[model samples]
Target: MESSKHKHYHVHDFDSRQFLENYFSDKSDMVFGDDTLKFVIDNLKQIFSEGHINGDILIDLSIGSFIHHLYSACEFFKNIIVLKVNNRCIMELKRWVDERTGAFYWGHTSTLLQEKEVNSDHFEDKEGHLRSAIQHVVKYDLDKENMTDPLVLPPADCVISDCLLDAISKDQDDYIRYLRKFSRLLKPGGHLIIIGCLDTTYFTVGKDKFHVFTFDEDFVRKALVGEGFIIDYCNVKKRTAVSDLIDYKAIMIIAAHKEK
Candidate 1:
């Protein structure tokens, strides 16, 4: 259970399964998967189709409990690593990946991917590909000095982080600091793909609230440039005001590469 007063500051007690049910459910997914998510998936498809995005290791930093964000990464990488913030999310993700009896159904992601001209058509085929591509699903902590310690993982050729920073960081300063930490996981010349909600203060699930650091496109681009990244692509999609999930101005998607 999360304290209603401090839910904004607590990360470990975040509900993984409830998040999946509220946001990533096949029913709820239709709202996002069709519109706002379209921009993100479209940009990914463009680079992949243009032969600009492909590599051995593609890392996704936590991405909360939802797995649909990595659906595009599966086609471009030989190995994909899904990093999580806690074991609860790990267990929830594993349940879906392992095809457990009561796992949250992921059919909607596959359905959306199929409509995008992705290489795979069959839902099982896409799931198999994602399952095969994912080599690791380890825990990550933005508060840590070294996000990963004791066990060293391979530096990624590409990293895809979706709104995890806003979820974990308590403020703009922490967000920038953790962004630098996440950048260290990439190899020189490696690509970083980010999808975030702009100007969000908080999002709720059930009765509990979680913090989302407020940021605009200029701040994100400026921060990444300061970290010595070359911006390849950046775009924002305005929310259609359909769901009451959160109050955010828009969805921002950015693709940048570290200097070699």
Candidate 2:
């Protein structure tokens, strides 16, 4: 027999140790605002309304601030799954879901940040199927060294890489490798959502330097088209604010994938 009462579980994970803190830190006051939420919700609504995610699987690769989006998507879809490759982010996600009810599943995430190992765990979960029936895989890559092989990567209905592509890759070749990998991760007509800041320099996590690519919107748009993802929509949100008594401005890009 099992208890059927909802318990208020206050679990916090390490997955969000980097991004969440940054988003809520003094520096974030200069970067993000209410418009960011509106920007994300609008894309979500567009995707969900298309009936693309009704019964489909969604794999949230990095599980940054977007975990909230998945929590909300659970209200519209019967099944939603998130993959947290980092132990820090996984803990944060569980904390976010502690007392919430939704149609979502979580995959295995270890403290080890190895793609091969994580992919192996995903494969074992798949058990030999060429494609897992999971809704989608939102792959977020902040560490470029881990963008190894997409052919071996798990299948996802849609892919959301938010400001991660440039953050991970050091050069265009590396970036192209990831874009190609993303193309292969989805079906011919699968959707890809990319949101990123343009002309950004670098971000730090706990004294470690993390790089950001100059996300040229025109260049990315052309690249996505070449990669075979149709441009369903494109929106750029600009923000200027004061954080830590300093002023900063940022430009963000949102693009939708086209059906094949």
Candidate 3:
């Protein structure tokens, strides 16, 4: 991982509305909604299209308060588990998982995936499948050695980490350590899908700012390869919108497997 000393923002609070507006509102207005989100989904969809993804458990450990990324992988796994270090984030996701009244509109994501499949009428079925696939949404604490802490988890078939490391980690070294933690949660030969903020150092959420550990594609590849992973797919897309909320120059997605 690459290292650089910079101003790190304090993660005081998390708001669902603010989070969505900053990242997922629209391409023209937001930092992530337009081309950025699609590239992420497209890379995942590419992996899903190649088959061999059937697994009993898929862990969404990315700390994403929304299910946009899961829209692509949920169909490939029998069970989905979401882990987050923030209580507010967990609550936000729970509200959506329970079919609460004011959940974000994720219809477009399902529509995108539906267009890829031959049977286009099963969009509802996909939603139902995802609701069923997500069996657990638990609290996580990155500061602890055992991220799960008191609770022990069964070996995961795949672990998805997206824009999470930079959110909580203090530095690039810490980021690498947390990655080892993620690898420990997976079984040998299991998949590790990571999405990163390429060459970005910070992001704003609500009133407080959060630090993003800046790194490039080379560091990412070397980090995963050093961890005994064979990168199957990797891509990076530069950010389109310019805003203080987003400080990253690009977004990256990687799909790799642990060596058995």
Candidate 4:
């Protein structure tokens, strides 16, 4: 597919609410629930449960307003700093954080996390905990050397990016460049956890077809290594559920740490 045919996320007006409803909602017919939501949640739970990724701060640079991935993260980090490339995503996230009306309901995701917990807490408590842990929701500029300039953030103990690279990057060089930026936000030895779709060209949300940078597992592994990261864990799940909304061969979760 020609890149020009697909819209860029930075130039496009993404319907954040519609995206949540389409994929993250509790609706029985959601397409990406099992392949994406469940896959990420389960891997995150196991990663955090292993006690290798806990720290004082975890920086989130994920796509969309989804918070399911952070349910397990709140238990491990005292603070979570969210960096968004667009205001739409920031507003959607703030609506949920501020407990405003019309915020996308994530109870279904919280429930999924609860089932994995040995001593499950109530949904309200889980939501409250995540909200309290989110320290800031700041805007970022990919073009800037300091993505979050004028608000110099302390080096985080861990950084989590979910599909943000693939969504924003135009090519392999852009992906590696963004990865370098994410690496700079972390302290040496700090872990970087990524959840990304593999071999995908585009994804649609409310009639907008957003370009997705296509890459394979070997490319990702090389990118991380070249950026001075030591891969600790990597998992890939082949696309199972059929859907016209997106074309992805697989989903990958990788846990790596900056070399000390």
Candidate 5:
């Protein structure tokens, strides 16, 4: 594929609202509702409830203004720091965090998560808890040696990223390089949970097409191992929804720990 044919996320201006409406909305036509959203929430709930992932601070480096995955995380981590590469995404997230008008409604996503909980609380309580847990929403530059730059962040107890590697990476080397950066944010033996689509080259948000680096399950395992992470759990689900917006062979969720 020619690099000129597709728009890179690093250089492009992504419409956070359009992206959310396209995939994260509760509409029946939203393809990623079950494949990506539900799958990630389920895995995260199980991972956090399992008692192995211990952490005071969790750094989230997910793509877009997504917070559904973090709903389960807030229960385990005292502080959640979200890192975004796009300013629009940061503002979008802040809208939700600050309870400002025009924020994307996440009631549906919260309801999905509540169903998985043994003794789930009210939806308002869940939303409130998640908002409180989010301590910071900061911008990061992957090209910089220090991704967070002048704001030198403390070593996190856990780092969770969703679909970020696929969106930013131009190739396998780029994926591995970002993985190393993610690992560097963690303390030795800290957990790292990742959720991403496999064999996807591009995904459309509204009229704009964005690049998505295609890779297989074997490559992910090898990459994580090479980055000094011990894989504890991995689950791959075949794509069931047929959609023109995105073409992904499968979706994968991985839970690993940095080697001590």
Candidate 6:
């Protein structure tokens, strides 16, 4: 594990500091509120509509800071494999798992399924069973950049890319390369769900360029298609998790494999 709990990387100006300062200052809960959850849930519903989920989804918990996306995913599908390659992310994920309820919360980090509780209702059973709907939550750690290596992933039906790609690459070419690696993580015809932002201008947040790639929907669609992903659904949001800060907005891309 790295010396730091989280991997040290480039930081960009995203007004996160100001928001946090104001947040701790007791200015407003709106600093980083539920809009992201709404966006994530809405996008997820659209993805679900495009295909049927059969409890065999694999979510790239690539950045396990918040389980908002994971929780929403579990609600729709039963079995989910959450993979986090970063040690810090794994530690963070551990904090997100609730010790008591075994339910999903903002920053839980305990085991959702307890081994000692056999037939103890630890797993989420089928509907009307009074048990949790989500059964197993498999966890793995692999560095994001090493995802292409065989050791990082296992076969999956679907993959979720939430706030991950932007933190992985510096240019469009590298981003495409990264996406291709992500593609390989899934079985043929598996789905990839991505959510992140794009701004025309570069801004700084935590000493890094927050908007390294000012991606437009057209550019991203072209890139995904070029990289062998068949576009299933795409939604361009005028505002994202950082809508209050700048003129640029975010885009959500949900795609699947092209018929070969």
The sequence of per-residue lDDT tens digits that candidate 4 reaches over residues 141-222 is 8888888888899999999999999999888999999999899999989999999999999988998888999999999999
lDDT of each: 0.76, 0.48, 0.77, 0.90, 0.89, 0.50
lDDT of 1 by residue, 1-260 (tens): 22234365335477777776666666635455544445666766666566677899998885556777777778789998888877878898888788889888877666766776634435458887888888888886555677767668788999888888777676768888888989999998999888888988777676677777888899999999999999998878888756777777788888899999
In the range 1-260, model 2's lDDT, one tens digit per residue, is 11122111112222244555545333324254333444554555555666644435444443353443343344344445555445555545554355245312222111111132325465342211212232333333434444432423545566666655655556677777777765665655667767666665554444343455555678788888777667776776665444422112454545556457
lDDT value, candidate 3, whole model: 0.77
Q: Name the runs in model 6 displaced over 4 angstroms.
A: 1-27, 32-34, 49-55, 75-78, 98-152, 200-211, 240-248
Q: In model 6, which range of ten residues has the least summed lDDT?
A: 107-116
Top of the candidates by lDDT: 4
lDDT of 4: 0.90
The local distance difference test score of model 5 is: 0.89
Q: TM-score per candidate, in order?
A: 0.90, 0.63, 0.91, 0.97, 0.97, 0.65
Please report how far candidate 4 places residue 24 from its true position, in Å: 1.2
Give every collision pair in model 5.
Answer: none
Per-residue lDDT of model 6, residues 1-260, tens digit only: 22222222223223333423321122344333333455555566556654464346565544334554554355455556566544444444454343434322322111222222255364333122212332334444224455444455456677777656665565788778777877766777777777765654433334333343556667678877887778767776655345334334654545555434
What does each candidate score in C-alpha RMSD?
Answer: 2.8, 14.1, 3.0, 1.2, 1.3, 8.6
Stretches off by above 4 angstroms in model 5 are 1-4, 122-124
Error of 3 at 73 (Å): 1.3
Query: What shift in Å separates residue 70 of candidate 4 from its native position after superposition?
Result: 0.5
Residue runs of model 4 more than 4 Å from their true location after superposition: 122-124
Model 2 scores a C-alpha lDDT of 0.48
Off by over 4 Å in 1: 1-6, 28-31, 118-124
Give the per-residue lDDT digits (tens) of candidate 3, residues 18-126.
7766787543556465444677777888887788555889888874586878877887888898997777777777877888998776676676677777778766677
The alpha-carbon deviation from the true structure for residue 45 of candidate 2, after best TM-score superposition, in angstroms, is 2.7
